[model samples]
Structures are given as structure tokens and as C-alpha cells.
Target: MKQTLVIGASLNPSRYSNLAIHRLVQNNIEVKAIGLREGVVTDITIVTDKINFKDIHTITLYLNAKRQVDYYDYIISLQPKRVIFNPGTENPELYKILDENKIHYEQACTLVLLGTNQY
Candidate 1:
């Protein structure tokens, strides 16, 4: 399993980001998270700021296009194998940026991918 980073993570259990975190852990994948507020989920701590995560194979986004604007450079800096634009987080601008940098990405649902054994 790829080591993943869940961006725009939420502390609320009902949110998909939260569920993804739990699912990723259940599947025995290394997972890190970044959210507005600091918190914990299934032994994973959600940080409030970027920390230059290393060897991140996948970055699954939970934020909308607008919120993602600020993360463009930060995401590229991490140099993940690919970025997953989950549902509403899809952004054409970011896609272009990633493409220019030679980073792979896909607009898909993280939960669905996980459920279907595709993640």
C-alpha cells in the first residue's frame, strides 16, 4: 500500500476525509493528515500546518478548488508519486500545474477507490 497524505482532513467522523483516514489505517497503509484544527483519528494525528512529509506516495485531497489554491506549491514540494482529487476537490488549475511538473493525478473518489481495492 502507498504511504498517503490526507489533505483538508476533518476531525468530524461523518466527513469522508475522516473515514478515509480510518480506512487507510485499517488497510495497513501509512497515512498522515493535515486539517484546519489539530486532532487525532485512529492513532493518526492531524496537523494544522504543512511539515514537508517525505516519501508520500499518494496525496488525497478533501478541500475544494478554492481552498486548494494555497497548497499548489506545497503539494509539489512534497513530490508525491501522484495526487488524488477526491470529488469536489478537483481543480483544473492544479491539474495543469501538476502536469507541468510531471506529476501524475486523477480526479476520483478516495473512498470509492479504497472500497474497490484500487487504492
Candidate 2:
């Protein structure tokens, strides 16, 4: 399983980001998370700062396209193997940037992918 980073993570259990964190852990995939406010989802701490994470194979975004603008460079800098747009988070500008940098990306739902064993 790929080591994944869950961006826009939330403390709220109802948020998909929170659910994804739990699912990823349950599946035995190494996972890290970040969000606006510091909190915990299961045993994973939701980091509030933008720190570079090494050896990250994938980044699944939960923020909307607008909210994602600030993290574009930060995310690209991480240079993960791939970025998952995760439904409403899709941004053409970021896609172009990723394409130019030879980074792969997918506009899909993380939960769906996990449920179908496609993640």
C-alpha cells in the first residue's frame, strides 16, 4: 500500500477526510494528515502546518479547489508519486502544473477507490 497524505483533514468524524484516515489505517496503509486546526483522527494527528513529508507515495486532497490554491506549491514540493484530486478538489491549474512536473493525478473519490479496492 502506498504511504498516503490526507490533506484538509478534519477532526469532525462526519468529514470524508476523517473517514479516509480511518479506512487507510484499517487497511494497514501508512497515513499522514493535515488540516486548518490541529486534531486527531484515530491515532493520526492532523498537522496544522505545512511541513515537507518524505517518502509519500500519494496525496489525497479533501479541500475545495479554491482552498487548495495556497498549498499548490507546498504539495508539488513534496513530489509524491501521485496526487488524488478527490472529487470536488479538482483544479485544472494544478493539473497542468502536475503534468508539467511529470506527476500523475486522478480526479476521483478516495472512499470509492478504497471501497472498490482500486486505491
Candidate 3:
């Protein structure tokens, strides 16, 4: 199974990123999370720093396109198998970069993918 990184994670229970983290854990998936604020979601701590995560299979983005700009190079450095552009986080600029690097991406909802067993 691929380890998932939840970017733009939130402590708010209502947030989809938070929900996705819970669901991912519920499905026994290893998950790491990072966000602007420090918080905990289940057993995982949402770190404020952009730690260089290893063996990251998937990166589920929750940040908006503008916010994503700053992390473009950082994310690419992690070399994830695919980047999931969850809803409002899609960016064509990043998509082009991913393409140039031969990285795969999907413009889809993480919650839906997990629920449908397609994650």
C-alpha cells in the first residue's frame, strides 16, 4: 500500500482534509499530514514544516491553487507516485510541471476515491 501525505490538513472535523485523514487511517493506510497550523487528527500530528517525507506514494492536496504555488518545488522533490488535486486545489501550472517531470496526477476528491475503494 502507498503512504499518503495529506497537505493542507486541518483540525476542524468538518474539513474534508481532516475527514480524509480519518478515513485513510480507518482503512489502515499510513498517512502523514502538514498544514499552516499545528494540530492533531486522530493519531497523526499535522506539522507546520514541509518535512522531506520518504516513499510518499500519494499526495492529496487541500490547499488552493495560489497557496500551492509556494510548495510546487517542495512537493516535486518528494517524488510521489501521483498528486491528487482534491477539488479546489487544482493548478494548471503545477500540472504542467508534473507532466514535465513525468509525474502522474488526478483532479479528484480524496474522500470519494477512498469511499469508492479506488484510492
Clashes of each: 0, 0, 0
lDDT scores for all predictions?
Answer: 0.95, 0.92, 0.94
The candidate with the higher TM-score, 2 or 3, is 3
> How far does residue 26 in candidate 1 sit from its true spot (Å)?
0.6
- TM-score for all models, in order of appearance: 0.98, 0.97, 0.98
Q: Which stretches of candidate 3 lie above 4 Å from their native place?
A: none
What TM-score number comes out for model 3? 0.98
Residue pairs in candidate 1 whose N, alpha carbon or C atoms collide under 3 angstroms: none
Ranking of candidates on lDDT, top first: 1, 3, 2
Q: Residue 93 of model 3: what lDDT?
A: 94
